[model samples]
Target: MHWLRGMWAAARSGVRLQPHHLCAPRLVLRATAGLALAGFAGYWLFGLAAGVLAMFGGFMTGITTFQRSWRPDPVVPLVCALTMGATTFVGYLTSGSLPLFLTAAAVWTFLGGLCWSLGANSGPIALNNIVILLITVTLPNSFDHALGQAAFLTAGSLIQVVLVMFPPNERWQWHRTVLASALTAEADYARGLKDNNTVHFTPDSFLQAREADTLSPWQAAHQPAGLRGVRGPAEEIRPILASLADPAATGPDTDLSRRQARELLDTAATVLDAVAHAVRQGARVALPPDTAAALAHPQAATVPADPAPRAATHLRTLLHDLIEAANSPRPGRESTDPVRPPIPEQLRQAVRTLRGELRHDSPVLRHSLRSTVVVVAGYLIGHNLPLGHGYWVAMVAVLIMRPDFAQTYGRVASRFTGNLIGVTLASLTLALAHPNELVTGLLIIGCGGLVFLFMETGYAAVQAAGSTYCILGLGLAGESWSDAMPARFALTLLGGLLAMAAYALYPAWETSLLRERLAEWIEANLHYAAAVIHQYAEPAERTALRTRDAVVAARTARLAWEQALVRAADEPVRHRGLPPATAAAAGQAIKEAARITMLLEGNLPQSGTAPVPASSPLATALRQSAREAAESVRNNRAPTWEPVRQALADWNTPNPQEKALHHAGTLLSNALDDITTALDATALDTTAPDMQGTR
Candidate 1:
């Protein structure tokens, strides 16, 4: 019953096409041109059969080119073309024997699934090759015919790859866009802070920006100054801004410190916007007059002397670096693009990743196992059925199923609904027009264009366009509407149901790991807070670096927990250990604690400054509590903060110089108590066991 409800929920969420304006018209036209040229040329040279195969070859290769990555656009398509050519030829050779072909295909599918261990980009490329293999194997041909077909298909893919390689000569275009977006997001966050609004600062753009830093050898030699080292300071600004505007650190809205903080934040926003605009436009940075003046004399508007930081001093320094980096002169543009890190480095990294995923607990391993078994089972069932085009069943499954439950189920619903609309429309068109080869070829090209145009709109839209395109291409090969449409529709449903059922039987639900995620986050936050508190006890370069590393780990853990919550939201299974309200409350509490720690971190004393000995016990207590609280969280028990409170109470009265540290200690003690209370107020149900586990 839970499984049925889960499927229903996934289907309902999937069919709702939340449209966005993110289309790539230029790329679509280029891809479509590749498809049209090969399709028409093949028809002219060989025959209608060659034209259909060539069209599919060109289109699937175009799909590979659409995957966004830091790699040169031609690299993925070229590799995929080679892989597809080899697999297609092999599949054709083995098609005469069912057992031999099925065995070969199962091996291919398993390896393809494991390709995810290499990277996100590798998975799609492998999937495209697998799809081609599945379709090609069903069509047994003589050696000559098979060789010619593979040649034509490879030729079509090469055509697309050539087109991609010759893109407009704007070096580091993708890198510039992502870096600019990260700066723009930071600018917005700063403005929101100035306005005292709750801003949701996500690391997604920054993460993408970091990925953009992976440059090819040619790019590395001639990388623009703006692209070289701007992201580090930009990333550091997020936490500092969060700390600067925190009311706990800067006092209430009516205070002079709060007003000063707002002014500095506004100036920070202006500086960030200037840097972002320069990166986006490939021009020199031009800071506003007021922003320049603010940076010139940051101390005039610094925060209150004690307890609060003079964050503007550090903020101005970072802003200067950002401007300098963005304004650095551009290198002369070169057309040469060497492979990034060469091929050897990429292969070594892939090997390392695959080795790591070979363990039993790895999600990639589990998913690969599931995909291999389901795809092979789908193939066997579809082939033995009375339906003529049995490959459609396996093809549908390949197109829909994904590693994660949400994506797999979402795609199942989207693909089935999309195929329904597409098959019906194409069937109706064939029944009415009864078009000839030339007209069918034109229609096929048109459908291909539609697919790419709406590619980013949603999966449902892409599938709708893609299904229509496939049906028209089949028409070019002499398949009638009656033979193609009804069978395809039935098989699409069967494939989706099969995928859903397979997932249900061997599910990898993220919901089961909610408690684990929370525990990791709690431990990380406490460790980071302790690091910051220790800096007050004994400030040093080592402690400063350690604090930096600890904060980064805490941020990563927080992001992991947030992602887990999203993945678990629509999953069928429930976390019996942690209720929804309890999880939210506890997460919020930890977030607040992190924020308080960041506030202290921004105002740390310089090395050789007077050490606050009283903070030592509090720091030690925090370090000890981190280990214990983490264990308590995992066991579904309320964590105690008595050690932190006891350390604060037993300490001697602070001198005037150490009052700020003492006050910060009191704040820390209160924050820890809030976490304890959040857990203690909510009872752990533990009425049922966890559904599943994932790493």
Candidate 2:
């Protein structure tokens, strides 16, 4: 019954999807144009072979890598065609023998997968060629054939570049789209707080926020970059929004103080709605005088007064920051972007990353090996079977298989089932009548549009549209319609089974890395807490930087741990290290520790008259706790409570700052102790291995 419920839930999840937005048309149209032109022209000008290369090399490459990266240069589609062309040529050269192909694929894929640490687009750079290689292995080998393949590959991508150079007709562009989404989300989030409901922000929201800040307008790379007006406000309100959207899902629920907090949240929501609309309508937002006057009063500014953070104060900061960003950004703040790493430095970093991972029991290395084995198996079996288009078996395996077992397993049902629905739809369209240039062109466009539209929706819809396009594309390239569907169906099923089998037999679990992540998280939060404590010793102008660094580091470690936990749950292997409950408790410990650090940092003066010392006793206790926490997490030892009483003897409660520090310290100390208790019960091998840089 439990297994049935899980399956049913997975099926339901496949249907619910995120909606597509219009502000960022991006390079989709251009890529689609390139695809259509190449697919149409190649078949007529050259042959089916030329068409096949164009389809894979041109359109697929352009569209897959169309999204902009962090560096704001004129975003040219650089990776796809190059990767596709190389894979195609390589596959052709190695196809002379199955053994040769397998050896080449294993090595090539390993190197490519190593680049994944580089960035988001790097993953495609890793997998795209392998995907094309799967098809390439079936083609006959010859030098002239490889050259011709290379020439058409170049032509396909060049066409996309040319079309992308053309002007667009949209107003509120990418920045507007991102800003609107963020503002809308925050507005909704504020309302959720006011109504006492759970509010969660998905990862998509983060991507949109990042783009609004980083992306440049098309071709006009020198035209001052993305939404300069909202940059300060975007940075300011992002964390507050995160707090509101925290998955912990506490809602100031019905206490007297919370009732007071709700009224302020409602006002904040109204302000957010106005700001949201102003940004949407391309007008500046105004700071509401009523709220501003309330905050301006010293009495209201020092909120909660109960040691715990005041949501009202947080809301005020959020609203004021939004107003300043919308109406009065500091001079020169909008004039520049943060210094990004130079190309040389970035390359150096990538090389260093690759070198570092080479020695470890890295998942990417293992995943690459798994992917290679499965692809080779599929490739060999398909050839042996009496099936046409045997390459799809390998291609599908490459597409579906991932580094982690659970993720790979989850995709099996979705991909196989999605392929069935998608191919059936396309097959039915063709069965109605043979599609000429016009019919085929419309079908391709519709399918491409849906694929991008539903890309984030989930795997099933994406596969459906993706498979439909592939089948239609193959048909246009001269494959008999009768052969295409059966091949796709049979090959996809075989591929799915192969992927599931590969994972089940010798599945890799992310749990092995959990301790490292936990250690990292503890270290990051400790750094953050120490920075906040040090502020009490001597208030510094640059304290915020330390806090910001801490936030970033903690967020990184937390994300890795969360991903590991999810993967661990689905992973067949368990009892390797911290058991499930202990691991979860450890996660909660770190989360709360991070929150306390954030609160401490928030309470620190940006720059001001030194108040009574907030350090000592409580501050000293927290600093000590942080050190102990990091050491405990790294060494797998239960942290001993070593509370120093010297500072407490000198402490005075009349100082509000000291009181607040005391409160935050108490929380951090409790979290550290919780982590100690959680790990204390573990009975793993105590002899720690020689690991890489512990810090």
Who wins the TM-score comparison?
1
lDDT leader: 1
lDDT tens per residue, model 1, 1-695? 77677778878777767576445677788889999988888778988777778778898888876777776667788988888888889899888888888888888887888888787789988888778888887664688877887898898888888888766433367788998998999998898888663444666677667667767776676787766667767866776787778775555555788788888889888988888888888888888787788888867678874444556677777777777767765422222122357778878988888788887656577777777787788888898888777777887887787877888998998998899889888998999998888888888888888887876678888889888988887777778889899888889999898887777777767777777788899889888988988888888879877886786688778888998888887777666667778788888788767767766876777898888887888888888888898888777788987788888788886485466667777877777788887888544554656555432
- TM per candidate comes to 0.88, 0.79
- Residue-level lDDT of model 2, residues 328-425, one tens digit each, is 53422443233445668768888898877664467776666677688778877887888777767777877777777655766777787789988898
Candidate 1 residues lying further than 4 Å off, grouped into runs, are: 1-5, 44-46, 140-147, 169-171, 195-200, 247-254, 286-289, 296-309, 330-346, 358-363, 530-549, 604-628, 640-666, 681-684, 693-695
lDDT of each: 0.78, 0.62
| Residue clash pairs of candidate 2 | 617-647
Residue pairs in collision within model 1: none
Q: What is the lDDT of residue 133 in candidate 1?
A: 82
